[model samples]
Target: MSCKRLAIIGAGSSGLVTLKHALDRLPGWEIVCFEKGGDTVGCWGNPYPGFISTSTKFTTQFSCYRKWDCEADPASRAKREDFFRGAEYGHYLKDFSGAFGLEKNIRLHATVDRITKVEEGWKLWMGEGTEVFNHVIVCTGLAERPRKVKTHLPVLRSMDELPEGKGIVVVGGGESAADIAHRLAAPELGNRVYLSLKTGIRVSPRYHPIRGVPSDFLRNRLMLSIHRGLRNAIGQKFVEARIRHREKFERAFHANPEGHAKDEAINARRKQWDARLTAAAKDNLFNVFHTKSDEFLDDVAEGRISIIGPPKGDGFREFSEFDGEGIIEIEPDIVCPMIGYTSGLEDLTDGELRVRDFHLGCLHVRHADMFLVGFARPIIGNVPTISEMQAKLVISLIAGNLERPRDLKARHEQERERVEREFPLLNTEALLPVEMFPYCDQLASMLDILPTVRKVGLRRWWKIMRAPASTLHYLDDDYDADAVDSQRVHSPPLITGLLVLIKLIDLVYRRMRRRASSRGSVCPG
Candidate 1:
């Protein structure tokens, strides 16, 4: 096949992974990666001090490269300095690019202004009106724009603008709120920080696996089996309930009971609902909460941090005084608004992209050549997995590997039918991180693209098994050889055997339970 010209924008984790995958799939293709930042990771522009990677190193790394040797423990979170300072991530990216012979293909210090569609493919416009590329992949990342906190509060302009060494309050209950609270409460800051969450959050119990399998592997397998049974009995509603239950279970551990109290009898009904949810979570292995934001609010109220009511009026005003109503009157030096980020695809693509109102930001694949990657946020999985899946799908489409009808109307109808049959809740939104891993795995399987595992010899595997996590090296030749072989072949025999054993155990457990129930002695629910 003739070499195709591909241009990748933003040299972050996603872009680097895409570059590596593209090189592997289309070795003859002319690939040019344009990164706005001088460094590869692009963390230089928006550097966050004391930032840590939320994802485990195993899941975070590209399929070919494993970070297991360097802090391989999935339970331990990687601090900014541990991986290499934020700046050093860029260097690792550079090294990754070089290792794959992609350094020469990358155009650093170059920003893509706009991408316009052409007759053949697309044209990317960079600085000084330089037009380039036949194909373009925008890997600019989710954190490109900051999400605005919609509150009428005059004192709180932005979270980042909050003063240090004074009482401060943060709104929102997601990871962003947790991160902001952690940052504000840091020992160095010496400031009282309060997080105003509408509802309490579910924190996962951190655990490290003794073997190759993650702790979630066994738990998720059981959950997935139960989910399948529920789906057969109650359909989509049951699946949704299970998903919600799983989330609540995770939240229960961090829940504060005091927050559930209400002043009025009608409010007590709301509290009942909260109690029901908490009880439901109790049945599961995970922990959850029935707490309100006011619990955290009270801590700030009592000299910890100032938590208060909603600001007067709706939306924003020109300016206002720092009156001590609900908010602390102290003048904040910096307000670190830890609001989340969204995909800013409105400016990039036209209405033709067709984003369903149900699933916002996800593009309907109109043309085989154009594809959207990292659109949906998965709650159960990792982001890299999603990106990898998207990349594989795109590659398949470009290679004409996907089964498609020639007739336009027939194809459209066929596509709709497929979506309805396969993904009935095609419009359903996904929670971040968790959904990420499964969605990526699903996408890759759909495209028949296996993960590119680096092959290692027996000696190398032995060495890696014996070596400590801190001393492990990913780029070692011994590891690479075996990983490469693993990528080419199907699932390893050992993995298949383990899977069979797990299934046998599950079957035996189910039969035993069935036999106990059939005895009519009233088996414990």
Candidate 2:
């Protein structure tokens, strides 16, 4: 095969995996990966103090690389049940590049300012001058730049600069705001936090419904199918059931002999949430982004962190009249705005960014060779694993090993519609916030790597069915199948039985529907 030149922007998890896969599939190809940051890991390259990842090691690690033994690496400060610290995950990414020999292709502290189309391929203008490549993959991540507000109350962008023993107001209803508020309000920190939510926020436990197992265990294929099948008809009820399951687990875990003293605060918060939801009937549970934090809400209940706005459909009040010195009347020592981020792809694409611009949020619809990887955010599941799958798909498309969709526009529209229906609050057009399970399976099916019952045998398939949705479940070119199986966690007896039953029913229903459709048609079921 002739040598092909490829340029990958951003050396985070997405970029490293893309480089590794490219080296493997298109050996001898000239690949250049540019990282604006001084390090290899993109997201965790520079993290704030006391930063912990929402994702667990089991689910977050790329399929090609396994074995994140925190016991061996005490610096990580993580256990089997604990989530990875930002630096620890960054270390893992660095190790990943080393393991796959991806460092040689990576250029650190190299920023690509502009990418333009050329007769041969694409032109990237970086600080080191111009470079041309046959293909360009933009893996800069979902948030190109952090969203900021016009506030003058000692705004702090990075949490690393957060001060203690002072009054703080954290803006935004997302995970960052919740986590930061929780951190600052801890008794040792001696800081009173006021969380200002623009509208309501969804909160889920880090681990609940089952102890020792991440709640993401509920995102198995069976649950995903059930959710997909039922969401359109009764999305509200489906979401309610999910909440109830989490609540049941939480109540069980927090039940204590102190006359449920801890329960008082939680119940108070629940009432506040219920009243707010009742006031705004349009903003159902489905639309809001669920913030996964174990102690954020607890802090709110215990009077450590007070909630502002998010009551009766009102958002955080604007601070239009700040004192001359940029001091607010409330006089908070610091104001942290975790509002959101903007998709920094306006220069790359024409008009506003939309789902129709890319197929599977990886391959660009207009340019066959161009791809936008790691922009899709999963509602539940690991992002690095998803990015790994995207890397495989991109290589397959470039190698002509996989066929592009004939109706690419129509497929994009369908996906957009699905995301809108399921996650209404999420803006459907721009950045992709996916359902995770079905999305991963969609990519896996395209690569013909989905772990079907026949492929892994019925026994192994059953184990997978009852376990957390690990990207490792899908067989990989690297890593032993038995080792992957050993890492997979089987749910408790009741949860396992329920999931198995649901899967069996879904299978039978699918078979019946196929049979009914094929009764008179010439096509096979």
Candidate 3:
């Protein structure tokens, strides 16, 4: 390690992108990037077969160079040019490393044994040798550590490693659980699968079952804003069924009930299939977890995967009771828990959330020289783009292109409030599960690279405040040096005006009701 040289830990998507951007921005600075694994794809490097981008390809690429065709033929099973399998995506990250000349700067197979803050800088050690760099960017990734199971039940990195044809119970429902269930249920494996999940969390489909559109294409925040305002204006009675929170959270299911499916028999079968979900979740078909994969539900319906969980009633054990023989009583020969995500963490204390000291988005609040990237869960969101945005901010801070006060009192106060609010849901310092668009926008604003696309023009406002969307909609924005100016960003949206009016009306009504009650007269309905 040398002075003025930047230390980049991990050659994943976030790490590689940060390295490329830093090199271009800081010509005179020295850099050394490290990867424990020999390859550069990070999580996608050794992903299971047939694994593809769960979201639109656009959402999974760096902003300046996301050339993947997002509008490709979704129906093609032959692996079209738009969405890609995991192997191809890994190759894409490798290409980025080569094209950006990052390979020469990277030292593969070098694992840092531990890191400590020293007087010179951050000290990263491998065995007896140690190196210190002026600045450190950690891209170890959110899911670097699989959520641990408390008991000593059998565990594995992938479900494919499960004993063939053995009964399996997958615990803690999430994308990982779905991945395992799908693999086990495939015709070749034919292993019985069971899923355990918490009720009331959402299970979103990759695509709209009826529209045949990928879920990524339709989860627009703008759509949510407009729908909310319109639904509020139209009265709750009229929109109650349509505007339910469950459907609102999951756009794919919303589209399914609105139109006709090409295959009538398939649709009927799907409804019959949905009944199982309603029964298992114990809260109607739509009331279960707000984020589940449709493929997982498909397995549940076809009986390929049996589900064991507590419904919306009493009697559901948090996970499962361990038997007296030091084994989980579940009969599955293999038991896997698809739990939470963390960054380079050993384990989580059942309910422990530490507030990380970070300011201006991803920079260390106290250790300003330290930058963190890819440390948050993109839970049902985007990681590549989010990581890229954070990368931009880190480089900007280091290069002196971004300026702010050293004491971030206001910002720190807000961070405290945010942690207090979000602690109930997730208990990790670096891996906050923020919604995609707002998170990106917040970071982009901090970096002073406000894309004009988010400005308050009628079109932009419509896109921002009124569209059902995935973060993919915000892709293709230029993040070059010329693009990083606040003047280029437009003012607030039209919804602000409507919100002001609504607030006034609400205030006036409250005053009238108070006055009537004070006078001992009933307020008019």
Candidate 4:
């Protein structure tokens, strides 16, 4: 087969996976990867202090690689320095690229300026000139732009303007806040730091549900039963909840219809959510605080941090000496904002790639010729699962083993109609919402259109079927004896019986409805 040319942007986790998948599927294809941050900072290339993946290493690793020697024990999670400091992950990526002869294809210190649609395909402008490619994949990681403290906290005015030796209050309750607090509390800094959390953040356990059947079993069962009718029902429920929430908000505000009451109402709602979130965070297994910002201010009154106004609906009110409270203030040296980030794809593309806003920044590419590999964000499923599905889909599309359904257009039209009928508000100009699990399942099913198993051992199958937990061990290509021994029996027959009973009830209900219709008279049982 003739080689095809492909260009990929950003050398982050997603970009590396895309390179690996493409090489496996299209061995003859000429691929080039571009990284703007030079060769020093992609994946494990650069190690920033206090850097660790939020995701476990098992879920984070590529499908082809297994981190654990045996499935009996969970794979150990790697700290930031372990994976990043010595360029361990970078070495892995380099080795992966070399294995597939991809090292020659990577171009470091290259930046993609814009992409323009051309007659045959697309043209990517990089550095001083342009490169034409049959296909282009954007693997820019999830964070589009960092959410800075200055942007979120208007009261700070400027980070540099803050005074020295005074405690700086940082608001936010996420992992970032924890890191910042740790930094401030360091002996070298010798500065008092206050963390203002409206509600506490929940820190996930190293592991979840030590001894219960995996949630995936239940979720899969529910998903399998979601036929067209169930989909309409689910969609309608979502619409109703949205409408009800809006109505409740309007009622609570009780402002003039012509007046601008939205801001106040939104603030009030935000405060309520903040309170609930804070409570949840406190009650979490970890040491999350449930105290209000005002309580923290009380501590400030005792020479902790300056007392800002009592935590009001719209965060702590901005206080000045002009106000009644005579609070002594000290300037804080550094203000670390733990605000989140958005996917930074706006400047990466010149609007040539269609992004579906609802899918958490997924590109809208219907053709098998163009595949989006790893765009799902904040999803529970492992990254490799989605990547593998994408790889298979693209492979099938390229090999001509799978063809777009003849009724694809009609199906899409029907889906639109269904959405409109069930979710009128969602029918607005915004894109259709696609959750991670459903998207993964859909992609997997599509790729499975042509069933072909590479190879599998009986021991591996038994281990996978009996595994009571969701782990990457199941997805690994290598099979180990310990993995098989650690497996547990499937859920008892009682649960299966209950499911069968529910199906039978539904069957009987449908039959009764048919009989009632056959008899013109209202069938009085």
Candidate 5:
């Protein structure tokens, strides 16, 4: 194949990985990665105050380029931590670039003002001059603009602006909101932290309820293979029980039982919050995606943070609506709205996450030369891993190693229908939410890298199925086998046995259902 010039926008985790794959796959290709920021990692380099990743270090890392624990190299052990701070993660990305010699290809403090499609290819307008590339990959992530909500209080644009030791109401029930609340409501801070939820959100603890392992450890091939409806239904019950148990445990162990009147006051306050939360989330509990947080729920139970609904009849008309009665007695000095972000991919996407337009959430249906990476939000997993998978798909397409479908529209419709059928409860509107395992598997299947039982053997396949859904498992090379396995959090034998039994029963039921349908379809003799 002839050489091609590739322009990658935004040298974040996504862009860096894309460049890595491009170097590996498209060896002779001319690649230039543009980073508008001064540093390599985009937002992570300048993370919010006291920002810690919700994802564990094991799950948040890039598939191919990641640090490993080595006895000889003590510095590599940082990768074994439970979670990564923003600065630590940024350093890791920088280290990755340096390790791969990718920095020379990356243009820091450079911006691509405009991208236009021409007969030759895509024309990128930079500050100095315009350049045309055979292929362009937009790795600009979702956090383009902070989502704003109508409120009367003094609104904080970002958590970086939040002051210590003040009455604060953090809006939104998302990860950012939860983390901010957890941090600001530290018992030592003496800050009255109140979390306002317009809609009830599902919260996943850092540790699994059953296995006491990282909750993400449960996000394996076997677990994801089960229907999302079933998995979520079971998950909802477990999470509720865990929360209840935490509440009881905290009250018994952490609280002062000597003062009966004081204890009643605390209980009443928590009960009020619980009632408000239960009412707000009444019907749509399963529909909401889980946000991983270790301290937020515990803080709420301990009376460090108060949970409330939107102010009554104050905000915009359509906002103040849920199952609960809106309004609260406490008036916050400052309000931080962590509602989410706009995609900022409007030029090509038209401010919409069209799965049809972006094939497999990477390739452009109309223009194969144009690709979008890191645009998907996984229901459970992180984005960097997903971006790596997408980058591989893009590289495969560009190299002509992967064949494009003759009918893309039909394929898109089929995929859309399949997603709707499998994940009936998902709210697929803005961020193109995907089941990470299935999505990655789809891309891996196209790449012909998906591990099969026959290829890997039954024992290895079982181990892969049981382990955390790391991207390494799909690779033919067992280079990172020890690194990945070292971090494995095994479930109890009884629980594992039960899970296998359930899976077998589900498989049998599916087979019987298919046979019955096939029999019914045949006309009687």
Candidate 6:
């Protein structure tokens, strides 16, 4: 097969940038991008309707042009906490596509149906025609399809259809659920809204408590190092418990003894939820993915909206069987399931790729030409950077520059085990959120943007040893096209040694765990 043409599906953030970089790295190579939406921005195509972006714009925004560097609005420039409206974000993505000159290569409104192996590399069916390319990259972000849980009331999936003078129950703990709850708690809704959480979830404010700075600013290399240090020093469980307790500890800020009678009333309202709804929140306080909330919790405490549902535990049961009084009260004017979307794995393949862990959930070993990007759903942090890093890894692999594990099967088995162990609560359909710091660092190391520890300067190399996490620091406009050419280019000794040491440690750890479990040692259950 001649490696002359490349086909990228989905013109989302990942696909768009992949197209741009491929052009830059592989000049004159024929690359065509298929986007089902008429416009390049996938989620942003109907951006105004998705409510607001939960992630802060500054860090979430990916750019090669540095376009957002100079904001004309004084208020926005001075304060980075304010989020952009959906329309604004859509425009920004469109601008990014234009800045990178990707419009020409993007075939708008093109939907890929299935891909099959071909003598030339792979064959694809897109609508009325068929095409084949040397490589195929799926960049569709995780919005596969909305999971529907049949409720007594008609599930209201759209925000515009929300009616006043009716009770609504929204089931979820992610951005969509929080956004809907906050909006429904408006005076017009008559305070008859409820949110049902199924797992421990964090409801975080847009800005930090003391500094009033955006949370994205704090998500840096230092924060990653701190996270690793805590995980190491006290263990992951302790660190997680501390995080889960953070919200409960913040009660001191709200409970004021010297306040007016109205303050006492608000506090009392908060207490009302103490027995009924706080069960999930208390357990999941720091356990689940954090949902960005500006007013969901405040409204809940003030009796504007009520909370319902038990978290994942012995108390927890399926939603269909749940007969919580809160659900019975509203009877639910409309049930909204804000649970996240799934990756459309079925559409990507007709054979062989059905059920297997694609390299870190991106690369495929059975059919090496297959690549799945923008599928990882991190519980926190923005996704564009993940998309970028994943794309970088994909291109590097395709070019034959990166090395596979000497014992590829062993590595894959270990990775699979780790994923399943780390997230026991997540179902098979749900994409478990990755630990961003190390995942991104591993991708960066693979790209050689930062070399293995032994090859770099002492200080720079030490940082990698600790954790290679930084957002804006690693964006690259160009890359070496010949990176995938060397078959013998194994990873540096540092990377190799680190992997081996980690395996040994994990082996011992798992053995201890098995022993503990056999002895009926306590688990989260």
What tens-digit string does per-residue lDDT give for candidate 2 at 73-191?
22332242457764788888888888888888888888887777788888888766988899888888777244555555566664465677987877766666777788888888888
Each candidate's lDDT (Cα)? 0.45, 0.67, 0.59, 0.45, 0.69, 0.60
Between candidates 1 and 3, name the one with more favorable TM-score: 3
Q: What is the per-residue lDDT of model 1 for residues 1-525, given as tens digits with 9 covering 90 to 100?
A: 155788777777677777777777775678888888776765432356545444434444555555443332323332222233344445556667778777777788897766677776777766668554556666665552334555534334333443557655555444555455655665566786654433334333222112322222222222333322322333234323533453353254222122222444434443333333333333221111112121222223233443332223333221222222343243333333444555544455543333232121222334544545555554444455466556655655555566533454454455345434434422322212223433443454455432222444565543333332111123322135444333211123443455446556667766767788799753422
Model 6 stretches astray by more than 4 angstroms: 1-3, 63-65, 68-82, 158-160, 189-191, 226-286, 310-328, 351-356, 404-406, 428-432, 451-469, 475-525
Q: 438-457 in candidate 6: lDDT tens per residue?
A: 68776776676754445545
Q: What residue runs in model 5 are displaced by over 4 Å at the alpha carbon?
A: 1-3, 68-80, 187-189, 244-287, 315-323, 347-356, 417-429, 476-489, 508-525
lDDT of 3 by residue, 291-313 (tens): 53556655655667765553222
lDDT of 5 by residue, 1-525 (tens): 156899999999999999998888887788999989888876765477566677767677776765532111223223325667658888888888988899989898888877887897888887779888998899987773446656676666553655777888777776767777888887777888877766776656565444344566666777777655456666566556555564553354332112112455655554444444543553462235566864676577677887676655544222233444553566567777776655566654344334336766777767878888998877778899899889888887888888876787678766666655545554343356677888898888888888788866786777788877778777633235555455453555655676788687767756666687688962111
lDDT pick, better of 2 and 6:
2
Candidate number of the best lDDT? 5
Could you give candidate 4's per-residue lDDT for residues 386-453 as a string of tens digits?
Answer: 55455555545554667756665566555545444533423122233333345554665665531112
Q: By descending TM-score, how would the candidates be arranged? A: 5, 2, 6, 3, 1, 4
Poorest lDDT segment (10 consecutive residues) of candidate 4 = 285-294
What number of clashing residue pairs does each candidate have, in the order they appear?
Answer: 51, 1, 23, 7, 0, 7
User: Candidate 4 regions off by >4 Å?
Assistant: 1-3, 40-46, 69-88, 148-166, 171-188, 196-200, 207-333, 357-370, 381-385, 405-439, 449-525
- Which segments of candidate 1 are over 4 A away from where they belong? 1-3, 43-46, 69-91, 128-132, 144-163, 207-340, 350-364, 401-434, 449-525
Give the distance in Å from residue 163's predicted Cα in candidate 2 to where it truly belongs: 2.6
What local lDDT score does residue 80 receive in model 5, on the 0 to 100 scale? Answer: 26
Better of 3 and 4 by lDDT: 3
lDDT of 1: 0.45
The candidate that achieves the highest TM-score relative to the unseen native structure: 5
